[model samples]
Target: MEKTTRAAFAFLLAACAPGVFAASSADLSVTGSITPSSCIPTLSNDGVIDHGKLTAKDLGRVTPTLLDLAEIQLEVICEGATVFTLTTFDNRAGTSAINPAHHGLGMINDDQKLGSVAFTLFEPVADAVPVKTIVSRSGGARWAENAYLGHEALTSFAAADGPNTPIAIEVLNARLRAFTIIVPARDLTVLDEVPIDGQATLQLKYW
Candidate 1:
């Protein structure tokens, strides 16, 4: 009887090993785009305007003016990995990304609130100094407008919690590469003359 029981147990173990001890596989590929869907206009402090809206024409020969990139960003956070990229009005660039900062490490920013991840430059561009730019809506009141620099004090945005909400990635480096701006709403007209509130979008995708 003992020999019979032993043989039965051995047979069961051999049968289970192949199915239970099999190697697993995973496809660790995440994909998305940095689509900033909001924008508004504000006056540059040094400019002649003190308490009025900034116009597109007011922005001199600088191809990319202040009112131009009010909604641009440099870093965007998503599941599995993070991304950062530059934005320009002349070209409609989409989803063209660079290598992951921390790939395969499963680095995910659980923090819902997002801070400025791009660094700022101090070079003078066509007479424009490397000062701070304030972000605000013109219609009602600025929801939250602060300078966007890694080291500077800036307002943070809330996370989406779900898959739909916009998720922004944390900036490992404190450097602003190129310029970014956003109009948070649909109406570009309001962003035209007065400091009225409007909505557009901006995001700094990883390139």
Candidate 2:
């Protein structure tokens, strides 16, 4: 009986060997594009939007209060006229529990909800031409106008479609309408003054 059981166990081990249950391989269709020139993008004041010092009392006791609008001049200087669009990576991702459009203000911890900031992109001009912002969710065959640029189709694939016409630009200019909103004072546990640390990275999506 023991020899029979051992034989069965050995058979099971052989069936479960490394190559016995191999996963089927699938083809990885790689695709990419090569662009001719590059661009140097910069923001005014090094892209810093300072909210400055704000007392807890300055924040509303209950309702969210909007801070003064901070502006950062957006400019992209290119080697030649090239098609490109911009995308934003939330530096403080997942910290914005309240709003998706609003980038995060760093938390005090896991529980305490900090504040949020939302910005708008406007006045886009490329190569001295008013290159109005447009989006194509339909694989670049058609494009519809889109003013917003927070992780929408404007920033995803359409921005980098070289074969299809992308936004042509040797130089690009735009303005960020940034507004910081402070949470209600009572919602936070105030042992001392806290710094509002909010950040995001704007990437130039190109082909």
Number of the predicted model whose TM-score against the real structure is largest: 2
Model 2 C-alpha lDDT per residue in residues 8-70, reported as the tens digit of each score = 998898778968775668799989988889988899998889988988778899888889998
TM-score, every prediction: 0.17, 0.75
- lDDT for 128 in candidate 2 is 68
Per-model CA lDDT versus the true structure: 0.29, 0.73
Best by lDDT: 2
Report model 1's TM-score to 2 decimal places. 0.17
Q: lDDT tens digits, residues 48-69, model 1?
A: 2122454544543423222322
* Candidate 2 residue-wise lDDT at 183: 83
